[model samples]
Target chain A: MEWFGANSFNFEFVSSVLQINNIQKSYGSVRALNGVSLQVPEGSVYGILGPNGSGKTTLLGILMSVLRAQHGSFDWFDGRYGDGYRKKIGCLLETPNFYQYLSGEENLRITVSISERGDEADIERVLKLVGLYERRKHRFATYSLGMKQRLAIGAALLGNPGVLVLDEPTNGLDPVGIAEIRDLIRSLRQAGHTIVIASHLLDEVEKVCTHVAILKKGNVLTDGPVTDVLMDEDVVELDATDREGLRSFLLTQSLTLETDKETGWIRLRFPKGQAKLEELNRTCMQQGIALTHLSLRRKKLETRFFELTND
Target chain B: MKIAPLLYTEWLKVRRYWAFWGIFALVLIAYPGISYLFYTGYQDIRSSNNKMDAMLKLMVGSPFGFPEVWHTLAYIASFLVFIPGVLVIMLITNEYQYRTQRQNILDGWKRDEFLWAKFWVVAALSILLTIVYALVVLVTGFVNPDMALAGIEVKSYYIGLFALITFNQLTIAFLFGFLLKRALLALGFFLFYFLIPENILIQLSRWRWHTGNWYHYLPMEASDRLIPPPPYLGEITNPADYKQMLQAIPEHILISVAYTGLFWLFCFWWLRRRDLT
Candidate 1:
């Protein structure tokens, strides 16, 4: 109360533009969103990474209020979602469901018309936005995967919403498509719109997401700034014939090593802010150890995900 | 202005199906066409008793809210229910059939808006059907100046009855459509019911068990209002109350209202509770 305009850490500037508090959904015996709590800060690119059937879609569905939260609450601070909040949010959740018989322009017209946004001008604006103005006259069925995905994005952008929620916005795209969508996400983020994406594509998330949440088996294992999660771990790797000798030496020296029998590769983890990887490499070489491969690793999301969920 | 978007969406949904246009044309033309044909049958059952005919022949200019108006509207629009019923099915059931409803939900419409958008479609149809009835009647007046033009009974009552008929037809369409997501299946069952089985059942209701009265509760019951009382309707009427019953010009009006209200109420209940996955 004392600092009404001040932004703190919890009540931080992005405390939560959109907050889901302790949501729990159970289908008879199957729990979906198990005690899930998340805060989507305003004007941030947030990614939710999970495997198939990991409850990403369910979470988005609940956010759009398509599926009601059986045991929790979702609050949106930027708009009036209490009754008419859906109007403010745009989404591209699944495969495009346009009238396949109609041309892209006609379909866009119908969608925008029904959307109750601007008039014919909005349709032209979206077609131009997706870079599909030339193919706007083609039927949606004839468009390629990239075009369809772009059109879906264009549809989500039809009303120029403050938040755009996309599920695998580039699931089937090639490198070019991925790059284009990444650029689009960047532009969207730059425009100060909140963008939340649920994707299985790690590199895509790594490139575009400012914050991320990981889910495995319907549980939100971890969520925070991407930089913080990625920068937390200090690890290194080595491939040596005397792996056993190296493990024994590392154990004696209070270092942790995990070996992969299939690849015969050994990974070593050390405490944070301690950069003694060069010293360790020097010791291995000086001891006449045949070091095949040597490298240091940051705490990547993949590592953190496996660390948290592998058990 | 906002309603335009809602109405625009309704138009987009309806324009895709040939059934909407085809059946609408059929209803718009069928009533007046049949009425003109009935003009040829004027002498066959023309009442001989001047007083009875004067009372029952349909007064043309008795003040607006007369019993005569409802009787005429009931007679004229009786055979028209089937068209609107099919339209209702097209309007509501198509969403479920094509997964458009779910997509619509994702496109930012709530379950209530979905329901409300559909209700607007039915309301729009009712207005169209009424205008067609008026047009046909108006054209018939040009062809035969002597034709009766008893005004619609109770403007407010007619409006309510209009709402009732629209709601009832859409609900029947909705109930069957909600259960089956296939357009062909919805259409096929609708055709089958309207054909031999339903007609035979109507006949059997009189000779079979007393439960035949429940026919009025079936989808056919509301549609039956579209067709005028058959010339031989008196054969099934009770001899004791025939005269008194025929005087009640507003027959079937209450049933239309009751049926529409119940359907709208039930649809909302089902929509709220059902899983949309």
Candidate 2:
């Protein structure tokens, strides 16, 4: 459901909420983040997608100031917010870190006091928002993994901050819990919060993220609008009686950016939304080639992620 | 940014924690109960025989009475300082075990703020335990059969010294917790260092050579020597040596204060530079 008004969609010139510049971090001999940089636009769901150990958490940790970077710097809200900038941003990094002995409500109270953003009254709103209102008085130790995660998100939402940084937010959630969190993130974005999510879940990122950065071994392989980074091109499977002729004719078309020969089919790629299967077939027929197989396949983010990291 | 909010935040974490209340309860019961036992034991020795009673009265004076009660209680209470030391270690290491230290910084606290928050907890707890020690002293002094309110003004400085010792010891405990980042490990190391190693070193230095006074300047040793034993033991043995040791109280206090400051400075520097995770 669209929680924000239509005017919120006007993105002609969106300012950046977080600007990371050339940050580098290392652990002994292993490099965790090597000169990584990105810009999270205001009121957008920015996703940092990568495989395990690809520095997704490291980069988020650096941005949140929990981990010190060996080199480079970052700015939140263009550094206009001063030292209290962190209070204006809600963050849940890595795991749900709360006092195990305290109840869910009590834990949020501590969070509110530390951030000094929301009052005790806001704690109930946040608990209800995360679906933990029913068990608000339950000790955090008694919470299931999903409940604990929900409480963490609830704590982050306590202040209604302008920016939210969530690292592997759906880590311990079940299917229903994951979907609920996904919707929560979408609704939060609709409410004008700029969310920066770090996740290896390609499907989740593709569904909710507006922008994405794919990382491989401490380096960002590609990043930008999701459509540009993950689905930059459309794929068409073309098989003809004469394979060489089909490949040769397809290469001459300006629409075809890449042509690959699979086992029994020829794969042709065109820029996103530039692929016209009927026109391609007609052009091939006009060249005296009758197509035996022709179909369009949308590039899945999972495939793109593997293709990027496998490099 | 202010210390009050940070302390309030820490109070929320421990207010419902059973371990915190458990240690506090132990102190309330044990501190006074142990002092009563010593008072009764001294009384029993004095009333046993006529000849021994005369000699004991000459040597012991009125230990549980007025001015001496404060010093006697401070020394006895120092032995139980490890109880609060254990609480400090548990509280700090629990943050590490749960990874809440990183969360605190992520929530809004600067690195130094987090360390300062913990230091405040250490200071607050020290002051609280010292208050309890003072209350026990007043009660013991008033209830003793040989109580005398005349010289009560003399040795009251022992209460302030007791507070300093508690603060220094707990600060050391905080350092151990920060370094180890594990509850069991920090507690184990603290107990080992406080109980076995430092004592062995101090005794070895004193008995094996003539340089025992040098070893009294160790972290816990300096604080322990602040109160020393009650005056009765000195009167029974070498009074001159005891007076000499008493003169060194200022040096021991300086060493204790320096160590406390050094530990906090080291923690602030280390925390600001190291990664929380």
Candidate 3:
């Protein structure tokens, strides 16, 4: 339960940073979102995990007001935000949609104007935060894809918005660029900004996101702490002295186990906190199968993700 | 007031844009520069002794000298419609092309603010173009030998109409830019609308449809009528005829006003109705 920061810390006094009601969106015949609702507590790095066209981008678009949802509504900071809510929320949607001809600094100046914040100091600070201060003078079009994405992060950091919404922040980036952005998001979360990231890369979410919602085909299959959901299964690797007897015993038992003949291991999963090593051995002894090798193996989110999404 | 930052945002977008500076330079030169050339040419012709030259000098007597200065400046400035049209198209269409329109709204701008940013740019361009023409008129009058301070008229109404016509033309460009959202397509339609469509439609209204005087009320033609062709070539030199030619007809002015309002209505509607996808 402590996998999410919510359990470790008392957030009762800290209001919900984002509350999405039963929001829905459609594009022609395709339903991009179908009455999706979620609440994001303050100071959480919430990752939205889904395959492409699973309504992740569409959801972010509706939240940012870039695209109107056909049904339902969402509120920011428990309805504390009004017309000026955008000044407190920074978003990078899909691409680094900056003016190609203008320098990064000039583009941020436009952002400053739109946000109506008078702090010119934050421009340099945000640029430095994204490691783009050196290239702030370069035209956006001249920069590589990684540099463009960095500048976009810098733009979103302007005015010190309380929340950041990023859609596929690592899209089209090299490994190093993805890591840089990942580190940036981690630091921003450490600094107490409520960050929301929509991504399909499972490992990226597992590494950085404290909470996650798995979406498939415009519907959220499940949502909770990443550790709580993905770690629901504890994999036990076992082999017995009577291999054929172990196989038949495993088949007769109510437990589900995946047997790999080449590795001479059958992997069985128990609910978290309920996988007792002695209990498993006792079951094998009663079946007249002596255990030769038994150990715990790391369970991968990739396996669980396929299991959940494929369903 | 709240629009200041929005204007600043728009200025940053276009301050370094090539089309911005290009059209700006073109308007600065085409208005005053052409006025200077016409003034010097009039002076040269006035000094000639040939019979045709003498008649021409009387016909175009000191195009920049007193009374004639205001009309001359406004007329030359009207030729600037196409340049600002192109500039306005670039300003509005660049948002769509770059996808900054979505970013701008996400940053805190209401959809109306996005439209106003472009509106203010058009308004500023019209005012600047009008003022440039005013300065050129004053300078042309100041340097002309036949210029008389006593006879000089500010012709504020004429200048106002000139600015209005410029706004009308720029709005036409804005409408097309919003409707098409493609620079080339918008510019092409802009060129065709102003250059060919108006003339052909007017001709058809006269020859084929035989609609008496109805063509002048058409949007582009109404703006064109705001600044009528300048009096040259020994035609309509009489005081009564000259005064009539110098002022825009009230009917045409009313039509231009209606079209200007309608143009903005369509632009705002487009901004509101369309998704910023």
Q: lDDT: which candidate is best?
A: 2
lDDT of 1: 0.67
* Candidate 3 lDDT over residue span B1-277, tens digit each: 4768768888778887775797778878888778878778777766666886668766766567777778777777787689778888888888889999998988888888888888888999899988988888888888988878886775546788888889889889999998899999999999998899889988898679987876767898888777775677325646664565445467678888899889898888877766688
Query: How does candidate 3 fare on TM-score?
Result: 0.87
Q: Which residue pairs come into collision in candidate 1?
A: A81-A85, B77-B226, B78-B225, B78-B226, B78-B227, B79-B226, B79-B227, B80-B226
Model 1 chain A worst lDDT window (10 residues): A1-10
Q: After superposition, how far is residue A199 of candidate 2 from its true place, in Å?
A: 0.9
| DockQ winner | 2
Error of 1 at B98 (Å): 3.7
DockQ, computed on Cα atoms, for candidate 2: 0.72
Given candidate 3, what's the lDDT at residue A65?
Answer: 80
Q: TM-score of each candidate? A: 0.78, 0.89, 0.87
lDDT of 2 at B118: 92
Please report how far candidate 2 places residue A10 from its true position, in Å: 20
The top-ranked prediction according to TM-score is 2
Listed in order, the DockQ scores are 0.35, 0.72, 0.64
Which CAPRI tier for candidate 1?
acceptable
Give the C-alpha lDDT of model 3: 0.80
Question: Which stretches of candidate 3 lie above 4 Å from their native place?
Answer: A1-14, A231-256, A259-266, A270-299, B50-62, B231-248
Deviation in angstroms for A186 in model 3? 2.2
Query: Candidate 2: lDDT over CA atoms?
Result: 0.85
